[model samples]
Target: MSNLNLSLAMGDYDRTRPIYDGRVKIDGVDPVCMLLSPEEMFFRAFRHQAFDISELSLSSYSISVARGEPHYVAVPIFLSRAFRHTSIYIRTDKGISTPADLRGRRIGIAEYQLSANVWVRGILKDEYGLGAEDIVWVRGGMNTAGRPEKIKVDLPPNVKVEEAPQGATLNAMLAAGEIDGFIGPRAPLCYDEEHPHVGRLFTDSIGAAEDYFRRTAIFPIMHVLGVRRRLADEHPWLPGALLKAFTRSKAMSDAALADTSATKVTMPFVEDNLRRARNLMGNDIWSYGVDQNRKVLETFLGYHYEQGLSPRKVDVNELFHPATLESFSL
Candidate 1:
């Protein structure tokens, strides 16, 4: 049998990729293409990169881009996690209570293109009656050293925008009263007694999603895996084998979770997390078998269009290949 080549999309999160990699080895599948971001997936798929999705009308690969297109061979395989944009945080001493209080205040974000920053800005515009012009915007770098791209948005004329160095530095700035509020992911804001200065404005992944859905009726598809559609079609048995491997790996993850001992966090914890993820996400993670996934795609497409990130509309159908449920029924 010829080896199968696959590509998976993953983020900075520690668990997802490690778990998938272990499963891939156990299942004996070979990965050929692997890009990290949903944005990159969209652009690469459009450009027909090494393993382009656009070239294959029927192949078994996973394509995670914004929600309006269909994949002939790929399937919407996972919910992954509910990623939220800014956890609007204020210093405890600032006494800012609500989103409304943030007007004219300074806000720090990781970067402009980062999904979290984009979603946060969208929420501020659609929900809080604040546009980009209403606050002082500060752009910070990522975890490692490098400057982020300058973001341009349609804000009111009064808002002043600037850039900073990093999230940790931004956190320091917040502590020093350099910024009034910080808009970033929830993980960054989870501080304890040692760093008690920050207070959460709200934990609103669902809220931001709801607002985004109300306007576009779609959820956002961030990180996704992609495969060269043509290759999978040539090897008809490839898709089923790949899906089966993932499913078995998922099952292994379950067994692993059940065996976890309190004294030591074994592979079982990872398995347990995978099992729970499967239960919570259902076929969304392995099969992409939900209408909600489509909604997310549509919403993301609209967002890109409105933001001027892309000049042309991306039809989901054109981006990925088609596959029946039975293709990933395992």
Candidate 2:
């Protein structure tokens, strides 16, 4: 039988590199893969259903599922995960020293539905007693102007979100103190350039994240691998095939990271950082699959619904393909 051909789009991360380079192969499939930035990949995926398989934002995916209009059904393979403590940047001059101080302040966000922003808001609500309605959200591009949310959202009446001033970027608004803070997956360029007043709300983000993990054991998931719903329905085995391939690809990356002869990544102190992460989280810190990540998924779903991204709470089981949820064991 001829292998099924499909288009796959995702970020160029270590865990996915093996699949791109042919080190890993999906069973009975021939994939045409493209390495793309999240913004481009996600916008195209959610907006146009451009690829047969792609990485999708968890928050956006939840919203789609809750609305009963999901274009793609997710697999259990989590492609990106991060602690969003470092995602919040604030103007030090605004006297915003803690998460609580963000109340009543104008915060800039590229999109309210971003996974990182959702996680940050959830952390703020859960940890700092700040609700999503407490602050004003100013939405626009991070560095460009007039960026629209890839998916349209009709948030509840209580949530206050406004667009950035005409022709303004969140990066500029944040640097100029037009917005008290900014939260997204990537830091504003002004913050990266070491602008005197632009600093992280959680100055010691590592410490905060470490503490958060210790308490919650959630290294928040940002993106999930998704296959188009029609395709998944047509090929019942595709989701499981994709899951197995991604798992092996991630294992290859994990093995490379642990090799001491030479660092697989272009960073200093690979061994030390790996040891630190394992000590803090566990051996399989960046784990895939549904069973082991239920708590994390449930927490995010709760946050997603509470923040008005999802009309109703989306069950964790509804987030992934059933075939990808489990596997046979010997």
Candidate 3:
């Protein structure tokens, strides 16, 4: 049979490089892969169904599923995961030395329903007893003038969220101290330029992330591989094929990074960082597949429902294709 031709949109991470370069190939498919930014990829994918396969926001995907209007069927091959301790940045002058200090303050966010914000909010509620009603949220683009949440959000009546002032952005407002803190996947450029007043709430983000992992053991997942629902229904075998290929691609990236001769990534202390991560997270720190990451998925799903992103709590099994739930035994 002729191979399927599909468009795949994803970030150009080391783990996905092999597929991008064709060093790793997807079986039974000829992929037209384009490395795209999350903003472009998710906007196009969710708004227009622009790609056959794409990396999709976990929160947005859950919202779609819960609304009974799902356009994408996910695989367990997670494309992005991170510890979200570093997502929160606060004005040092706001008396916000601790997470609990965020209560009753105005917080700026690019989108109230972003996956990173969802994870950070969950951490705050679980660790510091804060909830949606505790703070006023300002929503706008991080840099541009206007941005909208890709999915609809039915927030609790008590949660206060307002649009940014006309012609303003969250990044600009944050720099001017118009907001007490900012929470999103990307830090404001002003913060990056070492602005005196803007600082991460967690001064020692690495240490804080380590502590979070020790307590929760969750490497918060940000993005999931999504296949168009119609395509998946037409070809029941496609999801499994895609997952196998991505898993192989990630394994190749892992093996390359673990090699001590020279370095796979252009960074200092590659070996030391790898060793540290392994020591903290075990050998398979960035693992893929359903069974191996059930706890992580379950936790994120809980937060999705709690934060009102998902109308009802989504189940881990409902998040991925049946073929991806398990693999044949060796």
TM-score-best of 1 and 2:
2
Q: What tens-digit string does per-residue lDDT give for candidate 3 at 28-104? A: 89999999999999989889999999999988888998888889999988999989999999999878999889999
Q: Report the alpha-carbon TM-score of model 1 versus the true structure.
A: 0.59
How well does candidate 2 score on lDDT at residue 194?
98
Clashes of 3: 0
Clashes of each: 32, 0, 0
- Give the Cα error of residue 218 in candidate 3, in Å: 0.9
Over 177-290, each residue of candidate 1 has an lDDT whose tens digit, in order, gives 777777754334334334666766765644554455456543344444344455567755554554454445555544434554541243445656656555545533433433
Q: For each candidate, C-alpha RMSD in Å?
A: 7.5, 0.7, 0.8
Q: What residue runs in model 1 are displaced by over 4 Å at the alpha carbon?
A: 4-28, 31-75, 83-86, 142-145, 149-161, 165-168, 189-194, 203-221, 228-292, 323-330
Q: Is candidate 1 or candidate 2 better by lDDT?
A: 2
Superposed model 2: Cα runs more than 4 Å off: none
